[model samples]
Target: MNNISNKIKLRREQLNFSQEYIAEHLGISQPAYVKIEKGVTKLDFERLLKISEILEIDINELLEKQYIVNNFKNSDSSTAIGMVENLHQENQKTNELLIQTLFSQISDLKEENKRLISILEKLSSNK
Candidate 1:
């Protein structure tokens, strides 16, 4: 429960969202929202889903205890930031590879077109 609370708080803060904003979204009072973050109130699944949506995070991320423990321990934001950066880098690499493959395919198609044009010119001249 404490781990969940910590994760919610950490994610909220990371997004720079105020407690009152989250409370309004949840249709609850600020104090009630605070209790949820403090681990004094238990959150229902629906409410948890709503929170995850509002935070723009996956429900599994909010619910994973081990990940929460590892990332939130000592309130280290760098670990999470580093993970996001790494994912971004990987995505960039994948995009670059995809672009390269497309370009190569286009070049091959252009060459094939040129070869076919030359063949057609030779055939027409022979006639």
Candidate 2:
């Protein structure tokens, strides 16, 4: 459907399963799976329960963030985005570490490349 929607779809797809496969397990028709994937039809209780069980997801995931249930709240799309962004930003220090590592790799590769170039030049000169 959408990127956010597709993220959910991709999660289902990550197990190398198909919509029909999931529908069969859910005891629903293939068309129903299509409808759910397209976001045209709301997920029924039975399907939701099955989805939660199969996907190992929380039921609150389907609802809006403001709707708290059982002392847990759902995260809306914006909230999810913000949370992810926050997490990534929190990893900026880690990125600095990765950058140093990448620089070291680049330095190693440069030395290897120089060695290879020297060998190639020597071979070409002999030829």
Candidate 3:
């Protein structure tokens, strides 16, 4: 399991939401909702969406492996810190890739715009 249930519980606590509040939103009993947070019950897509909404988080945030890794704890403090550092490095790489992609897209658009402008200039000069 991904320990998503623990993440849900942590988010709920952070938001100060009671289990009853979540249960009411899900149209289930408090105990049933508790089961969901405790990983005893599997969440369907619809329910997962509802829970994400209630937590004011994106579904991707709830399901992200990075989030799970970030929350991981070990008895050894050094190991836990090392794991977090590794995740941060991975995130930096992902961010760098996204920035590179965006710059490439902007360059492509500028080239296309220049080509269109040149064509328009030629047409106007002929006129």
Clashes of each: 0, 0, 0
Q: Estimate each model's TM-score.
A: 0.52, 0.41, 0.52
Q: How far in Å is the alpha carbon of 11 misplaced in model 3?
A: 0.6
Error of 2 at 115 (Å): 86
* Model 3 C-alpha lDDT per residue in residues 46-117, reported as the tens digit of each score: 577789999998977776555464455543788777876866775565456456667877899999999999
Sorted by TM-score (best first), the order is 3, 1, 2
Taking the tens digit of each residue's C-alpha lDDT, what string does model 1 give over 1-127? 3656888999999999999999999999999999999988866556777999999999777655353555556665887777667656645654564566678778999999999999999999999
RMSD of 1: 16.0
- Candidate 1 Cα errors over 4 Å, as ranges: 67-127
lDDT of 2 by residue, 1-127 (tens): 4222343466687777788888898888999777777867644344555775666666555331232343225667778677667546535533464566678778999999999999999999998
Q: In model 3, how large is the Cα lDDT of residue 109?
A: 100
Candidate 3 local lDDT, residue 35: 88
Over all chains combined, what TM-score does candidate 3 have?
0.52
Candidate 1, lDDT over the whole model: 0.80
lDDT (Cα atoms) of all candidates against the true structure: 0.80, 0.63, 0.78
Error of 3 at 76 (Å): 11
What's model 2's lDDT at 63? 30
